[model samples]
Target chain A: MSKQVFIPRDSLNQALERLSSKMNVWVPAASGSNKCGSEFVPYRPDLIPLLNRQTTTPPKAVVFPQVETLLSYEYTKDPDNPSRVKIQLDDTSAGSPTLIFGARPCDARGFLLFDQVFTRGPFTDKYYRDRRENSYFATLVCLEWDSACFCSSVGSGPTDMEGSDLRVTPLKDGYLVEALNERAEPILSLMEGDVPTDAQQQDARKLQEEASRQRVGNVDLTRSATDFKGRFEDKAYWRAMVSQCLSCGVCTFVCPTCYCFSITDEMQGLKGERLRSWDSCMFFQYTLEASGHNPRPTRFERYRNRVGHKFSFIPEKYNGMIGCCGCGRCIRSCPVSIDIRRVVENLKENACVCA
Target chain B: MEASATTRLHQEVEASIGRLSTVLGWGAGYDPLHMTPLFVRSPEDIARLVWNPLCVQNLTGYLVKSPGVQPPEEGKKIGICVRGCDSRSLVALIQEKLISRENLYIIGIPCRGTVDIRRLMNESGLSNIRSVRIEKDLLIVDDANGAHNLPLERFLARRCLRCRHPNPVIHDVLLDEPVTPRTTAEDAYRDVESLEAQSLDQRRAFWSVELDRCLRCYACRNACPLCICQNRCIAETRDPRWLTQRVNLPEKFLYHFIHALHLAGRCTECGECERVCPMEIPVTLIKEKLNQITRDLLHYEAGLDPEAVPPLLTFNPAEAGI
Candidate 1:
């Protein structure tokens, strides 16, 4: 945690206007894609944009959105208390502390794969832990890598802080930063300038370890989570390997790590609210049933429950760690191109023909 | 790879429902083996019409189960029938003006494959087959293990081994004599194009070894007749129950990411969620990689033209040239 730079770009816009006077900063900049020049914007600290590569959508939509309004009722009838139910909680946005900045090391390792499903163990999501504890995050160090980048196979790269607190790098005119959380050492000791020598932190750690060995190398994932909990009944090899699935739903909305959701109730007659979008067990209406039963009722049991919920149930509930963050974005958004690395090399050649 | 076009499209749909039931007195017997929806009103019950391969239902789900799609006291207009994916769902319900191709008569036919009679009574042990018949390239199937025969592309049903339009592309009549078209395999999506020859830890070890047996149950969205919202679903709503009916594995990875993103760009590859999955789940290779991403990034083709449209209700915000 020792590297400071800055060299007057308004001292990084006065440390993003002193973290935007205590809340909401975002940054990134230039939102206008169509091939060529500037795209990833979120801005306000005088329109950020120093350099970016990802963001057609993801910064987990400023904390998971694409459609949000969890509650909103209003069926009034209170002639001196005749019946009451109001129901509100909708227009949110008050909780602030954001910051964000550059975000790149594969979107800061997709917030360590969304803090292992929104903050560890059994349910802890007060709206994604109150906007991820009033945000901050940081990260940048990519310098290059696309054709739908892979997060260097799985260990992550383009910088990898496992979810960043403060990272940066760039430098011929401005950045270096570094920190990596202890709530980023009082914003890197209220960072205001110099402290980058040792040949510019060994030339930004040898160009971030040669841009993480030219973008994505070690992808061995050598079979562990108890070797797929000992081959879960190989249904004739995932039914002759998912018969060219056309189940749509573009690889879980460009997954950084997919998190499914769906619940709607939009009301009008007695005022309504219940809403919770984002569902896709590869759709036949996400496991439909109400007496009509549908146990994964096929697309190959919904592509084998999307490859057994990312390698045997998110590693039997987060211990084996593999709900997919390799980030090839569902193999560059499959459309009959269907290739989850060839269904994991045909489940490692059907686990070497079941040993 | 050839023969069998279901006995010449059921003798050109029983002679075009016997000339639309002798000049519209109401085409013969409308018996879908009497599972209801009758009204052939009578023309000698058109010799109790029949079309083997037990007509695998979807006669537009019996034309919205009859009543008033036109049959209201009319002396005999409703004859119906159909095929090419049930007349492209009656041309997407007459281009969504919801049914009115002149009060109705249709017939159509031209299909070739059908029999999955529950995989032919689980591969011809033939339980109580009784009468099955098809003839030209065999099928037969009589009872207590007698008749037999077989050969129909073995059993058919991979959407009739890649059916190139079979016949009723729209239909109003044209029942018999079509059948000669058979050459499919346009590389039958080469197993979703050999999944770009794997390596991202073998596609995350092939979807975590098949979503470790998801049990969230919804019969692939109720035998999906275009999952037309069966009584409002977001996987069984309950205030903000955003999916936690707890079948496990982050709710079966949030129920296959909200059932493959609500069939993005409207999935119409129709394996009926891999023929109603009871944990058989090949969910059509995620709707055949979302029908090859709406036909290579939005050329769009779901339910082929009932006036087409729906590639995500029109969006080309400069074609995500964003």
Candidate 2:
């Protein structure tokens, strides 16, 4: 663990302004189109007020955009042989290193989760990896917790900065800076020396721990994940449970761990780019075949998959640990207020009946 | 035994439709050899119900298209007949809340693999084949060569060969004695796996050679049960045209990739996409890869049950190994 230092609360604006000169700094900005604020924009120190609140959009857009042009190509007549076909590169401009400010702890943890799923796989996504490497992350430790916040149960919480390069904790005068990765070293090196004493580290730790305890954030999901597979055949129960669900994918769109995407080619004139955008299984067409057959045509099966994957299948495939990070985003965002917490609680209590 | 099994299955369907008609006042019918939708209004019409090798149509696809049945005002239930695979789809639909369990009176059949008519046609190179008859486990194909005997298992639909669960996972009423669930591991995608095992260059070569045969007919896309976004697929859309109007290798590659990616985790190993491909493209190869991905990444199978959540919407933070 790196030592933390305090910067005067008033000097934050100046610090942001200094950082903006080097590279285009991206802070959460209001997206007028969606009437939602939180999309990253080029540095504007005036937007520091938005940093305290958690971003509406996850920081993922900063790295892996909703739609990206991986490579563009165009067809033109060859100079030497007009009859011969030739494919030429259209553009090769890549995004520069961006500094993302005020990312929440959950969003930071989301990056770590994405790292494992995307980086460890057989196919290395160069675009995502490159953007990830170039981007500098600085997260603000959460002082407040919501009912939707359950990161503590899955071993990560509001204060956990497992994936951040730099972590900032609010202090009386300003902010306490802690560098967690090599990338953060440069930023810390630039700061005036005011190293956090041993007492300060203890204080921060105690504060974070007490906050976690006071909020009662951790809900025991151990039994649910361990024993969920056996209960898969409980058709009557699961079917009844999800009978009220609407197959809208809002929960997925808001979720940080949902990496499933669909690829589409966009052609402009003779040039085209194949882009991958987020896709959800909740849609009717997600599993429906043109032959007019859909295997998962029911809401119960989709809901069961949601629970089974998080608790059983994911743990079985990755390790004994459950797949859910206990980030209760799904419970909060579901249109019908379908509480995953209650489901998990029921599963945990009923685990004794399972093998 | 096969004939009796089908007849018994037909009888069960009639009984359920009868029960549903009395209470809910709705009914079902069976299409003949072709995939034309069925409409049954009476008990006598149920005699036309045939569960032969030619029943390649996914009956679940026709359920949403009711025969003049309105919402709650019209009736309380919608009666239909479903095979084992069809029942899984129904379960998925019910679990997803697309169709209420209360609304459906399903007569579930335990399927002993359906025959692949396309594969049979290809083997004999017969264009004018008349009809298909199943005698026990033997498939009798009446073509230019009169009648030829083919082992049922040999020409069985790929989905049915490795079918471990041959009974409707969810059903209100079941028909015919459930056949002993077979653990027969049919190497359905062994060829795709072998091809994938090759180096990237070799794999590229193989795909190029195979795709070279594509005529860009879009038959495979038309045949897929999961491909319902035909009205607005990005490839053919005018608003933001995805590919060139001219048919070429690159355009075909894009179309295929989009199709495969669309079905990734959701594909239930149904071979309808490949069956309808006029160029005989093994479109299931893409679905197989996606199945492998879903199994490996999330350990979840699609369309196995109605209550299982689709993989894309479901996430486990713990699975991230945080």
Model 1, span B1-322: residue lDDT tens: 1123334434544555533432211111111111111234334344434454445444453344212133434443456666666666566556545456666667776767665443554455554345555677677766665878888778776665665556677666665656753434354455566764688788666656456443344545544445554435676564445764444466676667677667665655445555444334455676667666666766655665766667676655677522
Top model number, TM-score: 2
Q: Looking at model 2 chain A, report the run of 10 residues with the lowest lDDT sum.
A: A30-39
**Alpha-carbon runs more than 4 Å astray in model 2:** A1-3, A29-42, A77-84, A89-95, A191-206, A212-218, A222-226, A287-294, A320-322, A348-355, B1-322
Name the lDDT value of residue A159 in candidate 2.
71
lDDT string, candidate 1, A58-151, tens digits: 5665666544566676666677876765544554544466767777766556555567786785886566667777777777787654333456
TM-score of the second chain in candidate 1: 0.31
Which one is best on lDDT? Answer: 2
Q: Weakest 10 consecutive residues, lDDT, candidate 2 chain B? A: B23-32
Candidate 2 interface RMSD to the true structure? 21.9
User: What is candidate 2's TM-score for chain B alone?
Assistant: 0.81
DockQ of every model listed? 0.01, 0.01
lDDT of 2 by residue, B226-277 (tens): 5556445676554566764444578778888898898766766656666544
- Per-residue lDDT value at A100 in model 1: 76
